[model samples]
Target: MTTAIIKPQWSPLTIALMVMGFIIFWPLGLAVLGYILWGEKFGGSPEKAQAYWNKGKAWCSSNAPRHHRNHWNRSSGMSSSGNAAFDDYRAEQLKRLDEERARLDAEIDAFHEYMANLNKAKDREEFDRFMNERRGSRQGYDQNKPDNGDNNNGWGSNNA
Candidate 1:
């Protein structure tokens, strides 16, 4: 009988490092930093590490926002200049976008008008007659030929 051998179960070393981290590092900052840094080395993929950090950060922020207040703020907070120049820049961008949209709309309208004029322009019989006349002038066909094969349907032996 054959027996199957199971590989050792994989477990992340993050928890142990985190515990030791709390012991050695002042304010447990190193522990958190180590978790972030060596998480992939221990057993996590970069994606998994990122996900774990994101979830952990969220939980930590909720439970103790003031605990790692600096890290928490750096991660979550946003800063933007409230200057008049910034507001003007935004206004200019919006105005340019609006102008571009208006120009595009006008171009679309012009194209539609051009297409409508083209579509309503000509009779099929008139167009065919014009083409046949053009071809005859260019080729100079033998008028005396019986042309029975061509039969005025625009094809076959001129002698016919």
Candidate 2:
């Protein structure tokens, strides 16, 4: 006597609910679809659910890449492989890689600063050209104006 409305079977009610879930929110729809496909494996029990989770976890760990699997050991530097020579070699390589990464980071910073300076110079050049053109236009306009000392501000007076 399970009270769950959504079962793993492809009944009309389940299909309708799945479609409605998708229409409302896509992730909800995807969840419903997942339940429809794999609900029987969980079996509506806590122990079954836990077992399923553990199985998936084991699969993921087993399928991970070699470097990823050894990431913790490499990063912590506390694990030894029982070979002194190999350990020394690995330490030396890691140190060299760190130094190289530092050098590259410094170069990247220098390049960014150079680009910023170049952009500033270009903007300054454009601004100087604009100012010069503006000054030239104002000078030309002033030179073309009549020198007659009338205070009408560029508009001629109607009184002759």
Candidate 3:
């Protein structure tokens, strides 16, 4: 007989992390929240989920020492290579470098955007000024020149 089991196996600390993610981005929060709450249930039947969960549970229980090391690595944001202090320092340095890279990327994008907008405005202003000067020159030339449209003798007539 194939029996189905609904086990009471879960953790609430994951929910806290989900909440923190929501504080960062709501969609990311929702995705992780939904996965933790209903991922296996929706993904498959109860028997399948039970089998999957049990398999993981068996594997973890079989590797208690590795599990502890992995847990430490995740919680401390550093790998367990037999040196705690060095691992902590390495994690800190990596985190700082990531933050610095993000900051520099944002600054570069902002600077490029600012320079593009400045050049566009300058070009527009210069074009408008040039058009204004051309219009003024045309109007002045028309106003100062002669308009003897009474004779049809072309420019061959010395009837000045």
Best by TM-score: 2
Per residue, candidate 3 scores C-alpha lDDT tens digits across 1-160 of: 3232432224566677688879999999887787677665544467877877898899887878977867877767744658888888878888899999999999999999999999999999999999999999999998997877856546576665
What ranking emerges by lDDT with the best candidate at the front?
2, 3, 1
TM-score to native of every candidate shown:
0.28, 0.59, 0.40
- Can you write out model 1's per-residue Cα lDDT over 50-111, one digit (the tens) per residue? 77678888987678745476555544552233677886786688689989999999999999
Q: Judged by lDDT against the true structure, how good is candidate 3? A: 0.77
| Regions more than 4 Å wrong, model 1 | 1-81, 123-160
TM-score (C-alpha) between model 2 and the true structure:
0.59
User: Which lDDT value does model 2 have at 38?
Assistant: 85
Pick out the ten consecutive residues of candidate 1 with the lowest summed lDDT.
1-10
Model 3 quality (TM-score): 0.40
Worst 10 residues of 2 by lDDT: 72-81
- 2-86, model 2: which lDDT tens digit per residue? 5676678789988888999999999998988988898889998999999999999999989999878788676776477679999
Task: Supply the global lDDT for candidate 1.
Answer: 0.63
Report how far residue 5 has shifted in candidate 2, in Å.
Answer: 9.3
